[model samples]
Target: MEKYIDIIKNSYSGYWNYLKNEIFFQNHWDNYFYGLIIISLLVWGLEILFPWRKNQSIFRKDFWLDTFYMFFNFFLLNLIILIALSNTAAEFLNDILSSVGLSLQSLQIFDVDNLPNWLGLFVFFIVSDFVQWNTHRLLHRVPFLWNFHKVHHSVKEMGFAAHLRYHWMEPVVYKSLLYLPIAIIGNYDAKDVAIVYFFTITIGHLNHANLGWDYGLFKYIVNNPKMHIWHHAKALPKHVRFGVNYGLTLSIWDYIFKTNYIPHNGKDIELGFSGDETFPKDFIKQELYPILSKNKDFD
Candidate 1:
């Protein structure tokens, strides 16, 4: 709360400085935000050229709403991440690290710094994305939590923008969980962050993609659109206990959890929760839907 006030004060008090440093390239996430745009363009292009649901148009239903999500999440919600997570994580993790008589600087016994750049990058991506996968599963499984997560699943027409589609509160829930552990590991650096974003953001678009370019064996390693589309299935298939295929980048987590589902005709799967034809279409209305729900139960 104080942090939000501080950001507002900073922006209003020093408008130009805030616009230049806080809101643009100088900010920590600016590069990644721009990268998201480029990646969206690429995925949008691919979906147009070699689409899975070929009859679907580029400006499909809810297209602008999803695009609004893409930009809103990329800019404002992400800025919240930088402001809210950074200082909070630094303070929280420092206390815990001090209790254990270890520090991010002194965790060098792990030699994370000296590792080959590529390996360090891999470690960062794997650990961070695993955190995301776990959080995603919780959003579906936990009834109370699903209120905030339902905006993401309400999508019936999946595409590149669908990747960025999520409740605005998601970063707070997911990134805060992400921040503490990474701060403890203390292995994160600019290079590692960049590498992780490069793969995760780009592939994230593909996972929500309307394309049929599923890599055969590689689908088992990295999640693809085919299996992921089922995650949005209107109803669970028989024998499926809960929402399945809860992977952010790698499919191995679902395999390990025994939750991976890939039906033979998964590509043709219609999405969104069953009996949910009343989900709102406008962005503001959808944002407020969860708040106004009379029967918000997930289970």
Candidate 2:
């Protein structure tokens, strides 16, 4: 119980640390909280203005649960990643690297920071997107991994909160694996990081939102609400060979891999896993559900 209380305390502290960093920045705007408030209000507004499922309640089943997940992700899970996982790994890895007389700065693959801001952000965006695309796919394809990934898919009602909804372990796999490639690039300034996150947070929420319509001419290049809606389709789309449309931001990857599938409309789509009634209905249980079940298959 002491450990649990400490973890919760760390969560609030971790979130507040980032929240207070704005004191050092020039602007009155707090980057993390400002983005959170703005994007959330925007997405919520859009969902209200043009909801695809008109009859679905604003406080649909698990609405507050997903809300809990969003804050949980923002605070507790993120704190765990930083305190229990990321910082420890960084310290240990740095020690090992120093022992071997290697440094990340000396091991730079390309001078990414020297590049034009726009181009640098662009390259990082693509690299991160592709990494996320593959991560998303692996979450679906790998059996044990799918058990944890299933938390996101268990949502029956789609909304902005669903975007941050994830199992606690997800950041470990994603951030740890991502460390390898980004470390080599080695040139991210604060602006570049902010730019990348701008699109990720905004575009990401919009994709999972209950809004319809493929992005017309841009549908093939950029991912849209319509294309992504099918990704959560109850049954896999016919002819989708291996977990279709895994792309997070750009649909081009799916197109090149022939995993793209967007029907004329997403009206008939039903969300969540097929026949997933046994899945936990509460947040705490959902967090524990993945570990409790040892089944390899996503059933």
Estimate TM-scores for all models.
Answer: 0.85, 0.87
Model 1 per-residue lDDT tens digits across residues 1-299: 57556755554445434435643556454355566777899999999998889788889878898899988886665454455455555656766889999766675435445678778667667778789899988887777677777789898898989988888777777877886556545555774577677788888899988887668989888988888898889878657745889998899899888989876767777788855688887888888977888544444
The lDDT per prediction is 0.76, 0.76
For candidate 2, give the lDDT: 0.76
Candidate 2 per-residue lDDT, tens place, 1-299, comes to 46555655665676557646643543644376566658878998898999988987777677788878877786556555555566556656766789999987777788678888788888778888888888888888788888888888887778878888889878778888787677778758865587678678777788888788577898898888888887877777545533567878888999998888876577667777754778888878888987788753543
Note each model's CA RMSD in angstroms.
3.7, 4.1
Worst 10 residues of 1 by lDDT: 11-20
Once fitted onto the true fold, the runs of candidate 1 whose alpha carbons sit more than 4 angstroms away are 1-30, 80-82, 92-111, 238-241
lDDT of 1 at 201: 82
List clashing residue pairs in candidate 2.
Answer: none
